[model samples]
Target: MDFETVIGLEVHAQMLTDTKIFCSCSTKFGGTPNSHTCPVCLGMPGVLPVLNKKVVEYAMKMALATNCEINKSCEFARKNYFYPDLPKGYQISQYAYPIAEHGYVLLDVNGEQKKIGITRIHMEEDAGKLIHDEHNPVSYVDLNRTGVPLIEIVSEPDMRSPEEAADYLKRLHEILVYLEICDGNMEEGSFRCDANVSIRPRGQKEFGTRTELKNMNSFRNVQRALEYEIKRQQYLVENGGTVVQETRLWDDAQGATNSMRSKEEAHDYRYFPDPDLVPILVDDAWVEKIKADLPELPLAKRERFVNEYQIPAYDAGVLTADKTLALYYEEVVKLCGKPKVASNWLMGDVMRFLNEDKRSIRECPIKTESLAEMIKLIDEGAISGKMAKEVVEDMYKTGKSPQDIIKEKGLVQITDEGELIKTITSIIEANQAQAAEYRSGKEKVFGFFVGQVMKATKGKANPQLVNELLKKMLAG
Candidate 1:
């Protein structure tokens, strides 16, 4: 039976707030296991949890950015659970009423736009981490991450393939990072995903039994886990075996899913409105203010780059993938007034250098002004493209201006027509055999003469002038 895969992702992004959601404890990652804990986060008696205003504001920013509708009044509920990591028997989260709902993000799937529905975006407090002793039968709890601010963006089961799911996750991750609300670090547990995947016979109306997958730390892992889970369910159903509804952990090393436990529904959590915390009331003025402060999102920026700058859609997508990189490209274009040229250099050599060193655009050694100056040099014929490649590398290594690098290396282009003609005339005389073959209509030998000219000029000859002068001198 042909089966179709269904996927939905629940992403929990840690808000970049200084303190935990319900307490003043530090929300910094990697402190002494429990050093960041306080009376409130530790859930000590007689402590009343206070809601952090920054958390609410950050949630609002994401809600608005994702086109979610913010509720005027929302309340927090206690999710009853017990684990070594969860210090409080109940986690404070939004259940019955959430901060936002009914949002959608568009994905470009195979040259078509597909909209994925967002069920809800709710604010929740993160639980602590449990580290088990390697050689002992003991486990330790780190309450540092406990009570950290989290906004869970729940997507509807609208994705039909693993690629779509990955694309959707990337879009959300990009938005969170662009909004500056989350660092979007997957490995650090700042940005995480839990996938609910299932498979059913194609054209079936009702959905199949879905299994929740956890422990996928990266986007590739998420897509891989989903792909594996879909096949697992399909094989089970095809072989007349029942598909189980369970929470599974992705064994990344073994590349399979292991059953963790039974999946739990909302009622299993025993949610109730917290009596101590008051309800949140968002005003229109606050929503408008957040909307006003929202940055141009990735899709809009990409489209503008294509239309305004007249670059390719692929180029625009690569340039606008990151906010900082997009800003850097814009600055380069502004300085050089060569949008496509700037895009090529940035997308080509500049990005290659950064990726090779595993550095972000913020850590780039070549300043935007320096890159623009190099592109201008290329446009002004002050240097050939081949020479500019070496100069750009030097600029990256030494953090110097392109002009200085050009002067230091004495790599100026030999664009003088007279000088290039003289060199080309001598090249034709020296390589008379190859030049004779060229005159005899062995046109491929023309490249040999061009190579000789470049070698004769030590790669300083203007490539365009070389080609023009070589064609004329060889014909003679």
Candidate 2:
């Protein structure tokens, strides 16, 4: 029988606070191992854990961004577990009452919109890292990441395909980064995902025994892991073997999943409210303040880009994927008053440079005003579209204006009608046979004449004037 895949992603976004969630240690990514650890995070006796106000505020912003209902009062629980990295031998998390719940994020998959349900968005503390010595075969623990603030966004098992899961993860990542609450760096382990995937008969309502997948650090690997797991489970069922409920690790190099351990049930953690900390109370006034302070979300900004700027939906999606790039597009449009032109350059050249260099839009070499000036030059016919690419590259490399670049390199477009006709006439004389074919009603040879004229002018001749001059010279 044919089967379908079900997936739910549990994402942890490390809050962009200056310090740890329950302690004052630095929340920076790369620090001396165990240097950020303190008595509170080290689980020392007689030390009290103090809550960070910024963590709550950032969590509220994320919860609100995802359309979650905030619980005014919530408490933290002790998730009892033993691990070498978990210094406290238990994790501080939310259980019976979390900060928010019953929310959803909308994803556009293959031109169709789907709302992925968010089961909850809760605050939690991160565990430390365990580094193993490759040569010595000894393991050492690093507690620098201990007590780092994290907001876990759990999704309902509403995804049917790996593509949908990837789309959902991307949308969530965008939202978090756009809110300025999370850096959304997957490689740094700031933003991570644990996928729960299972396959069952296509028409069945009940889900099959699900396996939790971990260690998928990148988005590409997440989708790959899920696809592999689906096929593995399907193969098992077809061979009359039952699928096991367990946690698996995705080996990206091998492109497969290996059983990590038996998946523990919720009760296995044996959660209980922590006595050292008090419950967090978020009043309506506080919630309203955060809501008012929220930035324009991705969906709203995308719609505005299409409706107000008159760009295509695809352009809007690409531009609004990152908040800074979207802002950059608007600044260029304001200066050039050409939305499509701005969208094309931003989505094309701007994105290409940023991706190639592994840089963010904020760190872009070409300033927004510089890009606007280059685009405006194209509009004014000061340079051809082909010339604009060079101008933009110069702007990126030397941080120079388009005017300066054009003046220095003599890259200005040859828009003079007189000069274009002189070149166009010489080209027709060279391609006399094709010109004769054109004069005798072979319209296909028209393109050959145009190509020769552009070649003669070295692509600097104004294309419109070139075409006009070519047709005028060839027809005669």
Candidate 3:
């Protein structure tokens, strides 16, 4: 029997706020262990936790961006749990009332648009880190991350494949980054995902036993872990073994999932409304303010890039994948007034250079005006495309202007009609047999004469001028 994979992702995005959600401690990462801690964050005796208004505003911005309905009133609850990383003994989160609910994001899967349902998005505090010593059997706890603001986005079991799950995750990451609410750094743990996956018979209405996968740090790993887990469940069911409900950890080295512990149901947390914190009330004015400030999302921008710029959808998708890169492309197009040319250069050579250095668009050495000017030079036949290739590399290497590099290298296109005519005449004279063949209707030999002319001129002749002069001289 064939099996259908069901996947739902729970994403935890760290808000870009200056201070902790309920304390005045710094929210910066990579500080001395426990140096950013304070009495409120440490849960000291008689310490009152005050909510950060900025946290609520950021949450509202994300809700509006994702099309989630903001709750008029939401309350915080205590999730009773015991863990070393959680210094409060019980984590303060939303249970009975969450901040937003019932949202959706569209994904482009197999050239078709797929909509993924969002169950809810809530605000919570992040737990601390537990550092384990590799050399010895010792463990350390750092409470610096304690009380940091977080927004948990829970998706419905709408994805049918690992690829769809990855696309959905990328869409969310892009939106968050575009809104500037989250940095969307997976390696730094700013944006994290937990996937719950199961496999059931294709025609069955009921679901199979599911497992929660953790420790997937990157988007590729999330899809890989889900794929591995789905296969594992299918094999177990086919071999007459019962699939167990548990929490699993993805071992990246082994490329497999290992059972960690039994999964906990919601009732296991013993959730209850917190007495210390007051209920959050979001009025119409607040939601409208956030909605008005929301930036154009990735999908919308991609469509605009295609429709307005007359570029291919694939090019638009690649160009709009990153917010910074998208902004850079738009600036170049605006300066040069050539959309397709700008797209080709950025997506081809510019991206190649960035990938080779493992640098982001923000760190790109080539300036936008410089690239626009280079494209203009190519348009005016001031330099051949081949010469521009070298010039672009030099610009990237030294952050120099293309015109200056062109002048320094003396790599000017030979657009002079008289100079090109003399070279073409010499090529036709030397290639007598090929020139005779061309006059005898051997049209393919025309390319050979063009190659000879370009070689004679050191590839400096304008290609259009070469073709025009070659056809006229060969015919004569």
Candidate 4:
């Protein structure tokens, strides 16, 4: 029987707030374990939780960016559970009324645009981390991350393949980063995903027994886990075996899902309204204020890059992928005022150097103004493109300006027409056979003579001037 894979993603994005969701604890990622905790976040007795206003604002920004309708009134609920990592014995989250609902994110899979429906986006608190000692059978729990602000974005089961799921996740991540709500750093667990996957008859209208796959921190892992789950379900169905409905953990090393626990029904959590917190009321003025502060998102910035700067769509897409890279590219363009040249340097030399050094654009040693200066020198015939690349490499290593490098290395182009003519005259007399071939209408020989002249001048000769002088002397 033909089968179709159904997949949905539950993404938990840690909000970029200075404090915890319901307490005044620090929300910083890396610190001494348990250093950022507070009495309220630690779930001590007699402590009441207070909502952070900044968390709500950041959540609102994300909802607006993802085309979700924000609920004017929303309330928090208690999710009762017990785990070693959750000190509260119950997690504070939204149950009945979420902050955002019925949103859609547009994704382009192989040039075909598709809209993935977002079922809901709710605010919640993150659990702490449990570190297991490899040398011994002991576990350690760090409460630093407990009560950190999180937005749980749940998507409908609309994706059919792993690639679609990956595209959806990527587009969602871009939106989150663009909104400045989440850093979207998978390495540090700032953004995580739980994939729900099932397989049913190709034309069936009803859903299959879906299993939730967790522990996917990166897009690659999400796709891989989904693909593995799809095959597992298909094999079970083909053999007339039942696929269990449970929550599974993705073993990345094994490349398969292991059963974690039986899936919990909605009533399992025994969710109730939190009496300590009041219902959130958002007014028109607050929404308008956040809307006005929203920066130009990726799509709008890409369109502007293409229309205003005349860059290719591919280049625009890459330049705007990261907000930091986009800002850097824009600043370079502004300083040099050459869109194509700036794009080339940024994509080629700058990105290459960054990758080689394992650094981000923020850690780059060369400033945008310095890079612009290098490009400007090449544009004005003061240096050759090859020479400019050398100077850029030097700047990348030494953090020096183009003028300083050129002055230090004497790398200026020999644009003097008189000097170029002297070198051209010498090359023509030396390469007598190639010149004879050029005079006999073998046009390719002109390139040979030009190369000889450049080589004789140590590649500092202005290429245009050499070509002009070479053609003039060869004609004679």
Sort all candidates by lDDT, best to worst: 3, 1, 4, 2
- What tens digits encode model 1's per-residue C-alpha lDDT throughout 1-476? 99988898999999999999988988989898899999999988889999999899999998988888999999999999888888879999999899999999999988999999999999999999988899999998888999999999999999999999999999999999999999999999999999999888899999999999999999999999988998889889988998888889999999999997643553488899999799999999999988999999999999999999999999999999899999999999999999999999999998999999999999999999999999999998999888889998999899999999888899888889988888887777778898889999999998888788888989899888888877877788
**Separate clash counts for every candidate:** 0, 0, 0, 0
Error of 3 at 210 (Å): 0.8
Write candidate 4's Cα lDDT for 419-473 as tens digits.
8888888877888888899999999998888779878888888989888888889
- Give the whole-model CA lDDT for all candidates, comma-separated: 0.92, 0.91, 0.92, 0.91
- The digit string of per-residue lDDT tens for model 3 on 124-242 reads 99999998999999889999999999999999999999999999999999999998889999998999999999999999999888989999999999999999999899999999998
> Using alpha carbons, what is the TM-score of model 1?
0.94
TM accuracy, model 4: 0.94
Runs of candidate 1 with Cα error greater than 4 angstroms are 262-267, 424-449, 470-476
Whichever of 2 and 3 has more TM-score, that candidate is 3
lDDT of 1: 0.92
Q: Go through the candidates in order and give the C-alpha RMSD of each one to the true structure.
A: 2.2, 2.7, 1.7, 2.2
**Residue 184 Cα positional deviation in candidate 4, in Å, after optimal superposition:** 2.2
* lDDT assessment of candidate 2: 0.91
> Model 4 clash pairs?
none
> Candidate 2, residues 346-392: lDDT per residue as tens digits?
88887898889888889888888888888888888879998998888
Checking candidate 3 for backbone clashes, the offending pairs are none
What TM-score should be assigned to candidate 2? 0.92
Task: Judging by TM-score against the true structure, name the best candidate.
Answer: 3
